[model samples]
Target: MASRRTISSEKGFIEKGDATAFSPAALEKSNIAPAVPPGVIFKLLAFTFAMVVFPIGSYFATVNTIFRGKMSNSTFAGATAAFIANVVLIGYVIVAMKEDQSERLEAEEEAKKSK
Candidate 1:
């Protein structure tokens, strides 16, 4: 006697022992590309850097000079840092919106050209 292993298909049948059908080498041949734009990635990294560096830099820079290093003035330095963070966030938002708008306009132009 012999064992039989099979899988049904739309056209006919497939053997269950066909390991090559789902092999890593086969999967690696995919033609898919990254969905994100490189510019978007760069912008995200830039904003992240700004978010970290600007706030801390502002706090330290102002704590001694603008705020006189007093314990009470430390609060002002903190506030300034928070404000800089907010500004960076707003700038990121504005940049993303502008990029989206530009992409949308380009798509519309392409559609018009196609028609």
Candidate 2:
């Protein structure tokens, strides 16, 4: 069973601890704005490549000392760094995409009223 409650305040009407998520308006209204999504296989491929392959390959290259700048370079250290970097990059992309619509269409009513 669930409980129902009403919230009346001077500010506005809202529910307390509702399943509804952070009630936020469009990003354009705020200082932050969303970026456009990529299109086509090439864009996706490139995105995933940057997200996945490069880090893995870099890890191997770093760990094996496959290519090192100097004798002091530690293969293990390089590999660890590559792995961490790859994870960070992937997370960054996911967060960026989840933000919001880069562009929003004007409400039909609002447009009509303007004319």
Clashes (N, CA, C under 3 Å) per candidate: 0, 0
The candidate scoring highest on TM-score is 1
Q: What is the C-alpha lDDT profile of model 2 across 1-115, one tens digit per residue?
A: 8995645553332434543344455433565433634443455566666666666666666755654665655766565767776676777677556542332234555677899
What local lDDT does model 1 show for residue 39?
A: 80
Candidate whose lDDT is highest: 1
For model 1, residues 56-91, the per-residue Cα lDDT tens digits are 999999998999957798899999999999999999
Every candidate's lDDT: 0.90, 0.58
- In order of appearance, the predictions have TM-scores of 0.75, 0.32
